[model samples]
Target: MNDVVNLAEKLAQFSEHWSPRVVAELNDYQLKVVKLQNSFVWHKHDDTDELFLVLQGAMSIRLRDGDVSLQAGELYVVPRGVEHQPYAEDECHVLLIEPRGVVNTGDAEDTRLRADNDRWI
Candidate 1:
């Protein structure tokens, strides 16, 4: 747990979009890195909020009320139970912060969109 984690280096290890690779853990929460392209399914976490921090390029989180745009070095937190659909025009890198075991697809019924949890880089 004392080893340093490099976001860029880890990001280069994988090219699969929407798959989050666990980078580190803080108490009950985990930090994950993911590559995003196109759009993600609309889903919501009933128990915990999800944080999306843009590491490169740009992305948007579409909510029922409005949409939140984020660029590199920026972040947005989707509150618990708030449905959000993430979209990116081009490939974007993102760092996610959420509770351990929190599903990337949240409550979405489409199993194909769900990513494997606890995958470390």
Candidate 2:
């Protein structure tokens, strides 16, 4: 069985950004960690909502209406079916809480930045 997870330690296991690694699970949701830099694709999940909690640096979620900025310890929820793009000027660490099997790229078929399902750190 797995013991308590150290987020900073888990995050240190990977080098690439924009890809989320599963860290823990609760009921039907998964807690994931990801490193973010530059920009991500514009996409939306029709089946479930996505939660982003910043752990380090800052993040900016670009929506059609406007942009939502988040700093360390801050969070933002992208409601289901809403289009959004995430980016960071510098490297950012974040925790993503969402339902199991939720795709990283949502329903978008851009073929870029598609993370493997159930990947763990």
Candidate 3:
């Protein structure tokens, strides 16, 4: 547990966009690093809030009412049951913090954008 987990180093281990690689855990939550490009499916975790922290580049979380923009060193939390879709025009590195089993696509029926849970780098 003493080993340091460098976000940039772990982020470099994979190149697949929208797929998150687990890096660390705190209690029942998991810290994941994901590369994002283009747009993602609209989904929501009915049981848990999802956190998105921008490590590099920028992204936007589009809600039905509006949108939330995030740049490097910024973070946003999508409250539980809030319908939202994430999008990026270019390669964006993000740190996601959510419950261990919370699906990336949440309750959305579109399985194509659903990523494998608990995958580690």
Q: What TM-score against the true fold does each predicted structure earn? A: 0.98, 0.97, 0.98
Model 1: per-residue Cα lDDT over 1-121, one tens digit each: 9999999999999999999999999999999999999999999999999999999999999999999999999999999999999999999999999999999999999778789999998
Residue-wise C-alpha lDDT for candidate 3, range 14-69, written one tens digit per residue: 88999999999999999999999999999888899899999999999999999999
What shift in Å separates residue 51 of candidate 1 from its native position after superposition? Answer: 0.5
The RMSD of every model to the true structure, in order and in angstroms, is: 0.6, 0.9, 0.6
The best-first sequence of candidates by TM-score reads 1, 3, 2
Candidate 2 residue pairs in clash (backbone atoms < 3 Å): none
Q: What overall lDDT goes with each candidate model? A: 0.96, 0.94, 0.94
**Which run of 10 residues does model 1 get worst, by summed lDDT?**
105-114
Taking all chains together, the TM-score of candidate 1 against the true structure is: 0.98
Which candidate do you rate higher for lDDT, 1 or 3? Answer: 1
Clashing residue pairs in candidate 3 are none
Runs in model 3 deviating more than 4 A are: none
lDDT of 3 at 24: 95
Pick the winner on TM-score between candidates 1 and 2: 1
